[model samples]
Target chain A: MIRIEDLDFSYGRDGFRLTVPKLEVAAGEKVAWIGPSGSGKTTLLNLTAGIVSPDHGRIVVSGEELSALGDARRRDFRVRRIGMVFQEFELLDYLDVLDNILLPYRINDSLTLGPEVIERARALAEGVEIGDKLHRDVQKLSRGEQQRVALCRAVLTGPDVILADEPTGNLDPSNKERVLDILFRYADEHEATLVMVTHDRDLLPRFERVLDFDELCTPAPAPAQEARA
Target chain B: MSDSLYLAWRYMRHHKLKTAILIGSVTLILYLPLALQVLVDRATEQLSARARSTPLIVGARGSAVELALSTLYFESRSPAPIRMAEVERIRATGLAAPIPMHVRFRVRNQRIVGTTLDYFDFRGLRVGRGRPLAKLGECVLGAAAAAALQAGPGDRVNSSSEALFDLAGVYPLRMRVVGVLERTHGPDDEAVFVDIKTAWIIEGLGHGHQDLASVGAEGRVLERKDGRIVANASVVQYTEITAENEDSFHFHGDRSGFPLTAILALPPDDKSKTLLLGRYLGRDETSQVLEPVAVMEELVGTVARVRSWVIAAVVLVTLATALTMVLVFWLSLRLRRRELETMARIGCSRRTVASLVVCEIAVVFAFSVVLAGALTGVTSLYGPSLIRGLIL
Candidate 1:
């Protein structure tokens, strides 16, 4: 579902640079990327999702070359085919849980928010154990509940690939396990690829394969680590 | 677009105070100038309507504007008093009918208008209740005056004294409210109408006292000679003109020499009006004849000039408020930069994101417009009465 070869990316002049010689993950694969901070794990996710373009490389996700697509088409592909969860649970504070879950349909015209889609979003919220809090403001929820809401948003569109950047980084151990259970369950049910980046090595055993970030990205000429995603 | 509007509405709902503040600022910007215009237009209409109806005003040689104001509105202090002889002079001209006016006293906050019954006929005033001013001390209340004083027929109202400490000031005369005039929505609505003689009595020009020739007058009489009895200050004077003392109330001086504030001269035709106006234009004329319409127009012109200045000032204020509002919105956008970036990264196009912000502003503007329009409509409906209350 994802392939990258000869990927060269940098922040700017004399900044942190990342080089990926070769990487591939098969469809329906559940992979966890274990890395230190600033090891280019999140950067690889962004490139694969077409959120950022590589300076010199080819990126293929779900048989589509992300680097070849224009900005608008790439964005369309990302919303339609890939679901993304962030470390911060980027949900709008003004909206309730349901609106945050249905945000993809509202922000982009590629998807229509029909009654069926609403039903699906409700089902996803219910599956994440947040059905009762659908009308509550996201700010009023605990960190675990907020991450559950983000997971519902990512899976509501039923994308082919789920890219989560440390989705359980802010959760307690119990909430961390709950979030992973939901993420893994959705990927298994839909045969969707799951690429998660995390600092915790204890959670690596659940994935089909684990990739070390240092082995994937060559050492930068300068000593400073990359802070951007 | 509806989606964008929905999100915008949610954002506005979350920040209620900010939304309300924006609406209030915009509403004031739209309402101030509009309300001022409505009030000024109503004032102009009211001033012109009364002035246009009254063809001419004859008064003592002083400010024509003051004479018109006093004669027409019963507002402002009375100008120099013209003699009752001026009404006779206008009558002698054979070109117009004269209605003498005396507006010098007050019954509480209401003005006391002393004129012949012809003034009522000329001004289209009707007695809404009870009877007209038939007796020497009987008075009629205007509709608003009756409401303000809470008096009706058979009720007595004493004129307010000019000065409480001045021993020589006119004594308060208790006059009976014989009737009330129908509301005309003009200056007459706030006046207490009485006969010219009743106003003179209020001024102490006419008075009634005990009969010194009577059998009980022996102690009060200072002299009794040649069939004439002179009384001392101990003799009782009537403060109220009752039926018993009505016959004794008499003027001390010649009636023609009595004071009048102004005369409403009604000419039958344009030729008669021109002749009467020509009669008062002499270089030595002690009294001035003025076309009230002309004087009111001048006053309105001055008000219009001031209106422009006021509107200019409001516009400047509105501009400053608009700039401040823009700054507020710009700062809000800066604060929401992260939210906006999330929307864009989540696949909202630049246009869609911009549309959301625009929708928020549009809703605020729409609410302000509706509020301002409603306020202006209310002002248009009641502005004339408000101006009348203020001016009178």
Candidate 2:
């Protein structure tokens, strides 16, 4: 469940600006954001994950306001309640697939990792067809395999919301279909909401809600007034 | 440890070459000072211990350090050889027991030390195998000397020739090895022990000639021949001393005037040590009676100055190494900036990434310290032998 209202975010002097008066995704809903390149699709996901705070907005992620928490608390919240899949897969090469999947627990002490969690991780890797590569370094894996590993890591924490940026960008057609099946199936089973960014239009029919970023973005805002001495 | 440190360890293990090279740099940087300090301390301790045992050395007037070096270490010979008469006079006082030393020749790079049996007893030298020198030509090998020569009790070594062209210079004495001294871990370990008369024989002060009855024994005797019963071409000089020839080994000069390199004195008590020191204190021209320990302290003082220079050199090397290490590691971290950003983006705090880098450095430092400690232990074990090789 992610809620955004009056979200006004900007990047740089000559960067994309985003505006959303009101946007809400219900629990367990499969939503897709379809837009052109630099249309603020991944930026919206980053804002929702509290990676970068919005300039003028109120964002509620899993019933917690992003503006209410400090920077560290926001990071901890993201680690605990939301899982993100980057477009580049963002896997640490030194660690194997299992450790990358279990990274959330390693960083945040609030999440306890015990034998049951380890078993769940194995099960999740099995679902993603990477069970045999649990101990193999992610750098040795192909792009498709890395994509699957990133998806498994996103859902390994059983977070309330999953945010994916170009999750199926590098997969073949058939592999992409299978990946969507697994992702939606796992999210439905866990009753977690999903928000994915994609450039493909054919993949838009599967999501219950398809939000087009062309309707949500505006022209670049003027630069802020210089701070007086 | 946190997961950040665990990740750091994994990265280091994954990059074995990088880790090994960094650890090697740190280990070498740390080993220099540790090695110098350890070696210097061990040398000081050993020099002081040897000095303690040899309480006094009576030698020709010269540099005290030179006297200490020559007498205690059996290194360079004294510039002016003192007469053995001084040993007799020192003994007549009853204030001390003097052990005469004659070191004038070498056998296979091993110093041939000609001293009395009392020298062995006074120095606490024990034969690990065979017997002590009991005959004129019998010799005892120190542990290292025996090892260097690879000779046992039954073997023999010829004293080195001094003048290769001189036909009548002291002939090489074929001395039989009767025993091998136990490892004393001192200068004795590098010397060959024989009777003082044997040294005189090696010095040409004493010699052996064919007997009058052996003038024509198997035509093997060759010597100078003329007049009534004079030595001739038939009379021969015996190079190897046997039971028959050892009886003829006698000093020909005024025996008291025979040369000795040093006289090691063992005073009975503090009062005797004082009396012996006072007896020869003002008479610095003929001989110098020196407390070996005091002279060694002066020697150590000079060595301490050299050590300070070594320490300064060590500091400069350490700083240069540290600077290179810092530059290399800082550049390495910069190259890993993207990886660190990935870690931060994965919900790890920036502090965690910084801590990871620091933990990696700490691990390398810990490894270097342990490596340096092990190196120090090995050097300490071999310290005395190293000193003997370098100084003696």
Candidate 3:
């Protein structure tokens, strides 16, 4: 369900670079990218989500080449085919929990917010144990509740790939387990691919595959070239 | 666009106090200039209408604006007093009919205008209820004055004292309200009309006391020499005129010498108007004769100039307010940058995000326009009274 090859990305002039020769995750696979800080794990998630185009890369998700698509099409693909959960649980504060969950439909014209979609959203909120607080502002929710709201928003589109960038970074141990269990349950039930980046090592055993970035990506040779000059 | 507007509405609703302040600021910015323009236009129209109707005024040599305002609108400080003889002098000219005006006293905030019945005929003032002034101590109130005092025909209105500390000042006369004038929507709508003699009584020039020659006057009489009887301060004086004592109310001196505020002279033709105006044009003329239109026009011209200055200041203030509003929006945008970035990253287009901001501003502007329109409508409806209050 996901493929990347010859990925070479950089934050230019900062001398930071990422290199991935070949990486693939099967359909329905749950994968985790674990590494030290600044290991470019979150960057890869953003690239896969098409939020930013890599300097050079060929990325395929669900039979569509993300790098080949235009900016608008890439955005559309991201909204329709890939669900993203952020470490910060980036929900708009002005909106209540339901609006935050339905944000994907509100922002993208490809999805229509019909009565059925509203029913589905309510069901999704009920599944995540936030049905009663659907009208409460996301800002007033607990950190765990906010993450669940973000999870509901992510899966509301029924995307093929769920990319979670440390979804439980700010939660307590119990809440972290609950959020992870819900994410895994959704991937298992829907046959969706899951790619999560995290710093915690204890959560690694639950994933189908764990890619350690310490060996996978090597920094570019710009400083060596500078020394030679 | 609808979606963007819905999102904007939610954002604004979440920040309710901020939205209200913005709407109020914009409303005042839009309303101040509009209300001023309406008020100035209405004042010009009303003042010109009243001045054009009155032909001429004769008052003590002083500010013509004051004399015109006091005599025509019963507003401004009462002009220097001219004797009732001036009214007779204009009558003697055989060119115009003189209507004496004594606008010197007040019943609370309402001005009491003392004039003859000719004033009612000349101004086309018809009584809306009961009868016009037919006797001394009987008054006809203007519609607004009566409404303000909540007094109708058969109600009594007492004159307000000129000074609080005057130990021997004139007593307040409890005059019977015989009628109420139909509303003309001019200065006349806020005045009380009475006979000149009643005004003199208010001025302490005329009074009634117990008859010293009667049987009960033995203690009150100070001297009884010749045909004149002198009375002491202890003598009982009537504070009001009734049917039995109306005959006893008398002026102390010659009636011609009593003070009048102005004389309204209505000439029959242009030749008479010119002749009457020429009579008062002499260098040594004690009283000034003026065409009310000319005096009012000069005053209107000054107001127009001041209106221009006010409009210019308003324009500058409007520009400054607009700039400040823009700055506020710009700062708010900066503060909400994170929220906007989240929207874009969530697949909202850059254009849609921008539309959301624009929609918020548009809603605020729409509310402001409606509020300003409502305020301007109210100003237009009550413009005449507002002008009266402003000038008076």
Candidate 4:
């Protein structure tokens, strides 16, 4: 389970602010964050990923308190236990798709890579229909293909929680549904928590629960905090 | 290759043009000082060895440096000729082995050095082909001289004229190449060795002539007058000396005034050297004696001072070039910031990312060092021959 308590975050005093009193996500829950632009949905996702710590809050993912760890330890924890997919599909241009998918294991010494891990990476490429382009430069791939590579990298390590910020924001309707199916199936098979931020309301029906960021000014009946999933 | 190096090499391959330009520039910059130092050291070795072996020189009063250069390397032109009397006078001192040198002419643009067999022994020269100088007009060629003329034993070489318009100029003489000497890697290796008498023959002081006055009205030979032996309009001087006319070759002047360009004096000990130097110390206008080691020391010392400035300039240029390289590398890293950020997001520690970047730079530096070393190796191998060809 992932938990958040009394989180208060802001860009600056003059910028946008986010506040949450309490929230908890079950170990295998599928939660979606939906809101309009400037809703701090991506900021909230970044907080969960340990990319940005809150001004006043404590977060616990997989029962590990993130606020207690130092910066380096937090980064270590992020690389070892959590996987994040960026909105921009931040693929390293110098590396090919296969290397990009294997990047996490390359950097994190705590992760032991074996023949089975290599085979799983190859299988992930095949499943995403980028098997032929595994050695191709990532920048040369189409937007949809690059997006698939990013999704493959996110789940390649089979992390405890997958925090995806606008995972299918730039995909067409057909690619959007296909990529969503892949992400959901990967999460369900691993029994991992999935927290996805999306502007598309059409994908909301598939989630077990959805949080609306526009309701920040009101005290609602739903959960007040968005946790790991 | 280590994992970091593998990644560094792959990145370098990805940017092949950049890598090559950097390495090429570095190699060229590095090669400058290395090549200069090697060639200078080699030339210095050659110069000092010859100078140290030839201890003292005696010539008509003039530049001591030029006289030392003349006798030590045989490069002096129009060196005021000292007489054989002066050479004998010095040899009588019982303090030296005075070898007379008369090298005022060239055969096929290579110096024709006229001296005794002691020159060979003094310079540690040995016969490599055929035999040593055994008779007048019989020549032994140095290694480079033989290579230049492409003439060996049984072949012939002709001396070149020093003056073209002088009506009384000495006729060029044909010399039989009797031997070739082993390479000494010194100035002697580029010289043609001949007996001192052969040089006087080229100077017209001695010549082979016909008995023109002896041809009587009845076409019979007759005893010649003392004045008739002198070369005149009627006497036909043979341009060459051979066994058939070898008896006719004679000198018309006294032995006291025989032409000798310079005398190489090798002292047996320091006391002899001091005695010779003391004899020539007060005689300024008549002649001067010089130590080649001292002369060459002064010359190379001056050159080495200038070389220090050159080395300083090379160092400054290298520093500037290296600074520019660092700036270019820093700018390239700035351009790759997003790439580094991507690596960071992918669980690369900041230190690991820095290592990746530094590893790429180190690879370029290491490869360039190797390239510079390779270039130096090739230049060191071939540079001596080029320098010898130019100056020997």
Candidate 5:
């Protein structure tokens, strides 16, 4: 579960501030954030993942307040409790697909996922149809394949929460549906919370809940016909 | 840890040019200091060895350093010649065994030494060829000198100018190459040996034609039979002195007028050396006896200070280079900010990234140390022959 109340963030002095009010998601919930450009959807996802801290409000993930923890402790908390799927895929080119999926466990030694973790990862890869590409370099994969690899890596550790920012932005329509199906199915089966941000309306009905960030953020100007008199 | 090492190795292998440049700079920095240290150490060893072997060097009262360098090291300008009388005075004391050395000539650019047969015994020289210099005009060559001139026993070689360029005063005196000395690993390896009378003959002091009619009526008929007058001829060539003219090489004037450059003395014991030194110190003027080893020790003491300072500077520079290399590597890591950030979001830690950078540097430095050490070892083994070739 996660909670954000009146969170305001800024890049620098005199820069625009992103404001979010009263956002909450429960355990095993699958939610998609739909917004136009400049709606601060990615910024909210970053704050939830503890990659950025809120300037004016609090954020809680898996019942732990990320804003109260120091930088080092926050990094440990993120590694142990949350998995992130970046928009750019963000895979290390030097590592193969298997190592990239196994990286979270390697970093946080306290997380004792046994041989069953590898089995779960292999099953997840097969479910995503990337089981044949396990030993291949991540760079050699196509955009759709890379997105599926990112999705599998996100839920590989069975973290309490998964934050995906524009996960299928670069994929075609059919691959986009397939990626979303695998992501939502895995989150529901493992009882893990999923928060995805996207502007794609065709796949919006697949999620259990949808939060329209246009209403959560500052309202845009009226349309041209309404303003023209 | 293994994973980190694997990542480090993969990164270096992918960036081959950058890795090579880093390793190359380290190799050059380490090579310079190590090579200089080895050369200076070897030079100091050679200097000390020369000093400990030669007991006392007797020469004209001028530059003691130049005298020791010339007589012991075969370097520097020739000193003013001393007299046979001075040699006899030291020899008659019975406190020391004196060996006279007349080193005012050279054979084909190699120094020609004129000393007694006892010289070879004292120096522990072994003949690799025929025999020692037993008779007048019979010469022995060092192994290097023989190889350089392409001469062996039964061949003959002539002396060049005694001074730097005294072509008008050139006296062509041929010497029979009687023996070749085995390699001694000292200054003797670059010299040729002959009896003392040969040195006098090469210097135009004995048995040399000098205007026969101007000398005496007896000398005139001998010059006419040779079809030339010594003063009129541009060059004077003297034949080898045999048993017929062995006594003719002696000085016509007082024995003190004969030219002798330096006398190497082997004192009987510590007490006699003290007495001999006291006797020389008691003199009024014109000559001084000195212990070569003592003066050399003083010289080496002065050299050691400068050497230590230079070595310290080299060490500091090497350390600075290493620190700079580390800094460059750190800066390079920082330059890959976006790449590293991507790795971090995926799962690598700040610690793993740091380990990767350290591993790359360790590989570069380890390879450089090995290469520099091998280069130093090869240079040390071949450096002596290379120096001999350049000098000789």
Candidate 6:
């Protein structure tokens, strides 16, 4: 469902580059990128979600190369195919939980998902134990509830893949376990690929494969003058 | 689109104070210019209407607008008194009819114009009460004047030379109100009518009062006869109207020395008008004959220029205000980066974001337009009275 080959990105002209030489995830695969803070885990997820373009090489998601698309086309492609979750649970404060879930369908208008799409969203909310908060404003919910709502919104559109950036970062132990369980169960039931960036080591066992920062990043060069002397 | 509008409504509902401030600013920008336009248009209409109605206005030599305003509209300062001889000269020409107007007094704040009965007949004025001013010292009040002073027929009221009290000048003249004129929606509604002779009496020309005492050892005392307060009661003194006093009102000392602001001439034909104009213009050094309609056209032209400039200024100001509001709204959108980003991540398009901002501004503008229209309508309805009150 997604592939990255020799991808490199930087914040500015003088900033250090973040490089991912090669990565791939097959369709319906649930994978996790576990790394320390500032190890470019969120940057990789941002690249996959098409939120930011890479400086070099290709990022192909569902057969569409994101780096080649214009700004408008890239945004359209992202809304249609890629669903993203944030660690901060970035749900629109003004909208209720159901409206937040249905936002993607409203924006594109061509997405002719059936009544079953709404039923699936409601069932996902029940699975995440946020069923009672469906009609409530997102701002009124607690951090864990908000995170679960974000997870529901991410997979509500039945997208090809879901990119969650530390989805359960603020959750307690039991709530974190519940949120991850719901996320993985929905991905498997819908045959949707899941790629999550997280620092929690306990979540490593849930994914089929874990890509650690040391395995993904290129090694730094040693000093050249010491051997010459 | 629906989503954009819904989001816009939510934003406005959330920030009520900011929306109110924006609407108020827009309303003020629109209201002032619209109200000014109404006032200027009505004033121009009234001025032109008066000018078109009066065929000829003869007054002491001065501004034709002032002359027309005074004779036809009863507005502005009193003009220098012209002789009845000018009326005779114009009458002998036989080119057109002539009506003399003597405006010298006021009952309360309303002007009291004393002209011949022909004045009312020429203007087609109708009385609402008893009769016209057919007798000396008898008067007809305008509807507004009657209502303002609460005076009716058979009631006597004191007259002054000004719209308001001028105690240092002449004392008020006592006149009996005999009639009231119907409402004309013009200056006539604010005037009092009387015979020209009464105007002369009010001007200190005809019969009234004279000093009845002489300076004596104890200052002054009324002359006594048989212990009665009789002092030159039957004698003809300065108070009596005589043939000599009548001649004094007629200025023959110098034909050119006559006091007249302007003359309103209604010639029998275009040729006669040209002839009358040619005969008067450049015939004297101190006076000039002017066409009121022509001067009024020129005045309107000047006013149009000023009005265009003001309209342009108002339009520019409105445009600038709209631009400022849009820019402020745009900046506010930029400031809500996190919120908008959240919406964007939830599959909202860039178009939706832009539409939300535009929708919010449109709602504010619509409300402002309605508020401004109501304010302008109210001002237009009462503008004349407000202006008159301010000026008077």
* Every prediction: chain A TM-score: 0.96, 0.91, 0.94, 0.89, 0.88, 0.87
- The superposed Cα distance between candidate 5 and the true structure at residue A127, in angstroms, equals 10
* Best candidate (score: lDDT): 1
Which regions in candidate 2 have their CA more than 4 angstroms from the true location?
A: A11-17, A172-174, A219-229, B155-158, B162-174, B207-212, B218-252, B278-284, B387-392
Write the residue-wise lDDT of candidate 3 on A1-229 in tens digits. Answer: 9999999888676666878998899999999998776777877888888888888989999999998888888878888988989888999888999999998887777778889888989999999999999999888899999999999999998989999989888899999999999999999999999999988888999999999987888755444333210
Give the candidate order by descending lDDT.
Answer: 1, 3, 2, 4, 5, 6
Q: Rank the candidates by DockQ, best first.
A: 1, 3, 2, 4, 6, 5
iRMS of candidate 3, one decimal? 1.2
All models: lDDT? 0.90, 0.83, 0.89, 0.80, 0.76, 0.73
Instruction: Give the least accurate 10-residue stretch of model 1 chain A, judged by summed lDDT.
Output: A220-229
Candidate 4 clashes between residue pairs 3 or more apart in a chain or in different chains: A195-A229
- Native-referenced DockQ of model 5: 0.23
Where is the poorest 10-residue window by lDDT in model 2 chain B? B221-230
B1-392 per-residue lDDT for model 2 (tens digits): 46767877888898889999999999998888888888888888888899988888998888877778877887865547999999999999999999998887889688889999999998889999999989898899999899999998999999999888998787799999999999987889999999999999898888877656542454543443563344456556788899877776666769999999889999999999999989986844589889888988887887789889989998999999899999989998998887776555557665666788888998898998999889878988886568545644
lDDT tens digits, residues B149-228, model 3? Answer: 99999999999999788968967999999999999888899999999889999999999877778897888888888888
Worst 10 residues of 6 chain A by lDDT: A220-229
True contacts kept of each: 0.52, 0.46, 0.44, 0.34, 0.24, 0.38
Q: Which stretches of candidate 5 lie over 4 Å from their true place?
A: A1-16, A22-38, A55-211, A217-229, B1-42, B83-87, B102-261, B282-285, B308-327, B353-392
On TM-score, the leading prediction is: 3
What is the Cα-based lDDT of residue B356 in candidate 2? 84
RMSD (Cα, Å) of model 3: 3.5
Question: Which residue runs does candidate 1 get wrong by more than 4 Å?
Answer: A12-16, A219-229, B126-157, B174-185, B208-248, B384-392
**Model 4: per-residue Cα lDDT over A32-81, one tens digit each:** 88876666777777777777788888889998988677767777788877
Model 3: which residue pairs collide? none
**RMSD per model, one decimal:** 3.1, 4.1, 3.5, 6.0, 7.7, 8.3
Candidate number with greatest DockQ? 1
